[model samples]
Target: MKLNLFFQLSAWCICLCFSPVLAQQNYRNNEDINKALRNLVNNHKSHASLKSLTKTLGGKDVWVLTLSNGKPEAHPAIVIAGGVSGNHLLGIELSVKMAERILTNYKSVLNQTTFYIFPNLSPDATAQYFGKLKYERVANAKKTDDDRDGSINEDGFEDLNNDKLITLIRVEDPTGDYMPLEEDPRIMVKANPQKGEKGTHKIFSEGIDNDKDGVFNEDGIGGVAFNKNLTYNYPYFKSGAGEHAVSELENRALLDFLYERWNIHSILTFGPSNNLSVPLKYNSDRANKRIITSILKKDEKLNKHISEIYNKITKTKDAPKSVTAGGGFFEWSYFHFGRHAMSTPAWWFPKFEGDSLVKAPKNRKANFLKWAEQEGIENTFVEWTSIKHPDFPNKKVEVGGIVPFIMDNPPYSKVDSIAIKHSEFIIEIAKIQPDLKLINLKTEDLGSNLTRITVDLYNKGLLPTHTEMGAKSKWLRKINVSLKLGKGQEVLSGKKRLVLGIIEEDSSKQLSWLIKGRGKLQIEATTPHAGKQSITINL
Candidate 1:
């Protein structure tokens, strides 16, 4: 009996040591995510709180986890958002795992920096990954008529091959615009007419035209995409963009929460749009226009600096440049919300290196498949199989391609390591947030009981107190330097309250006041985005 009890206790100890690793072995569903978040908050009650902002159209809760050691509003804040694109499941995983790692190991980071983490903004669409028929979905559950053909969801994808996965179908035809690449026959590329290449095949999604409208799988179930529904450069009249910007519940809820949090100095998003691996360039023409569309010159310089730091910390190389389509939250956070916004896909297939005798393929798909083969990753490609299609009965139709979500997300085993590196990057960014300090104080006594008080308000942090674009925005509060006087204090020079327009990083502005005063007095410097500091002086 004693030996059995000892064995049972030993087994329990082993389970406790490896339980977290076991739980993270697979991508989590909505229920699992909710439970994980609740457990974190319950375990770390003093530093974490989870709130359900609202439910997505699919009834999944849109949760925001606030982590701070003290009052969240009192400290400079950073917003870490994930799942901006529904198809990027790795983003959701990274966001949640970063939060978990922070709560478990990096609790000291919360002392000066508050974090507002939006784990999964596209819950409705991300759920499709775990559904019966898996494909790359980007829309929510709003019941949108994507093709606008008067009928809703009539032309959805059909599993013709009975493979339980939605891939691509190609047809061999003389007038086709796409052709298989010569280097790798498994991958397809659009025929380049400029290079004298002739089309040999046409490719379409693995689906039948159920609506018989010539387009295959154009309109499907679900509604607006959260990433495409934001208010920056909104794609009007486009499918999945909704009737107007900020139309979906998830987008509106997130924006509303962000608008109210004036302490948020920067936003870090895990999404397909990337400005971290490679920074944005400044265009003089666009920056000078009445409506600015480019990053300001100063902001562009800051972006480059941060990009260098990100590369050094993450050791990520050869990151592919991604364009921000209209209505993406990544650009919206910078252009419209007026904050330091940064985004990255967080994971991609490593660049394929060929031997000196062979050149690497330029096509992304071809290169990805080559790298997958070298890494011994299996099941990423579905072999092309002949299938009888209703639309192309006369031609040879085959269904096959790279599997959905594999190219965008790494395998589950690699998630923890990726999350750790990204979490370190986030902590480095938080450490450099704008911090205000009062330094270089001088007091001179004049002849007749009068004194002159002077001090330099300095920004000691690496980032400026206000971004160049944020300085023009009315939403961001201005730096206020005020003097609190004793009973008999009189200000003979300098305004009692001074508004410093903007303070660059590692820079200072001198403020001097001629006063006829006595007894104890106080001076305070405050801003919502950068923290506040106060000093007491005895006259």
Candidate 2:
């Protein structure tokens, strides 16, 4: 409503790429790769166009990936975005594969929907994953004044040990806030006051403060972590979140793209959190394997209201440039675009409630090995090793965990399997969306002045026009039929025959009407809930 300033940079940045995937191989770093992607998008002007946007937080443009199939202005669209968050490369990778899908599976899928995929939103951050610097990379691959200390990216985490990685160090500092887990010593828990907390412990990042800003390595270079920097509940001037909404140039660019395209019926984001993999991730309490019933039981009205509110807030941008980046994009899709939306973490590590050991070993150390062995992700962790530190006389650090691979970067080898499972899920989901298709139509030739018209309507997607409960609650589009006899003559039914109910795909209803026609007549069968179709009948 405030002019949706988030998309202000939409016009200037047309960040482009090359037509061939091979061209991308030449580019190194996100900046180059993003440019190539934009060039490729630019080549497809007939089917699509590429737009780049810069946010207030990020200095550069975020490349908006888009593609169109079928007749323009008439077909439904599916917007696929991968790199919305820097950490969610899997989303971006899937998007790249989605391009492959266009060549292999697009023909089969093009009849019903068009897909627009932006493989990597933060190529700068994505590039860091492959380059020499695997860690310490954030979204934009740019520099930031994280602590707002007037020093731009003057400090950052470094691999002091020359071990080729930046790892967290838990030292025995007298002023440390973290302590080993009583249940599992390897795990560190924040000291809880109500539960009789201890007095000694502290935690330090991999390196010392370069800028010497009193705070140790607080400000680092990179664009905003978009998930935390949006307009809705946007932590204003908060750490991680930049000066304001749409702070990063890339975020604004994406918002601008959404504003220009209104046909996107639903919004989907590949980022740090998700509804499918983990529904209602965090409410007031943090519980593993969350149960909807438990969430509702905690506070029925509040949870329901939050669910509805969150869903609505996450959709798309209407004003195009008004979004505030991180929060702006989600708001634009849901509230602004006025459509359904979803966001998911590219990867996740499901934690068990209790540390269940496969066998009772004489002694157990706190580490992911036992659980990793059980779940088969043991390769992700590295054992603790001793190192000579500038600050500590002889300090030891564990350089790997589930966070490094499964949460941070998934094994490239697992991409194919993960993609297959996710693609299947995506396709299954596509089957459930509100899809309208013309099934059957029949006209009977009766005696003079008498003709029967029947039309069948089917919603192939998974969700019905309205949920069973939603329908009963009267939350649905109109479910009525309309007959257009001529230019000026039309008959509209008032009875709500749609039945506040749910109908699965392949299941349909036949609507028949007795009309008076001596010659050819135009009959239009309309179902506002599932779309409409028309034909000619004679009596």
Candidate with top lDDT is 1
Q: What digit string (tens of lDDT, one per residue) describes model 1 on residues 276-335?
A: 899999999999988899999999999999999999989998898776889999888888
lDDT of 2 by residue, 415-496 (tens): 5555555554444444455656556877775665555667776666644444332333233344444454643322233221
Error at 477, model 1, angstroms = 1.0
lDDT for model 2 comes to: 0.51
Candidate 1 CA-lDDT value: 0.90
Off by over 4 Å in 1: 1-23, 356-359
lDDT of every model, 2 decimals = 0.90, 0.51
Candidate 2 residue 379 C-alpha distance from true site, Å: 6.9
Strongest candidate by TM-score = 1
TM-score of each: 0.96, 0.66
Q: What range of 10 consecutive residues in model 1 has the weakest lDDT sum?
A: 469-478
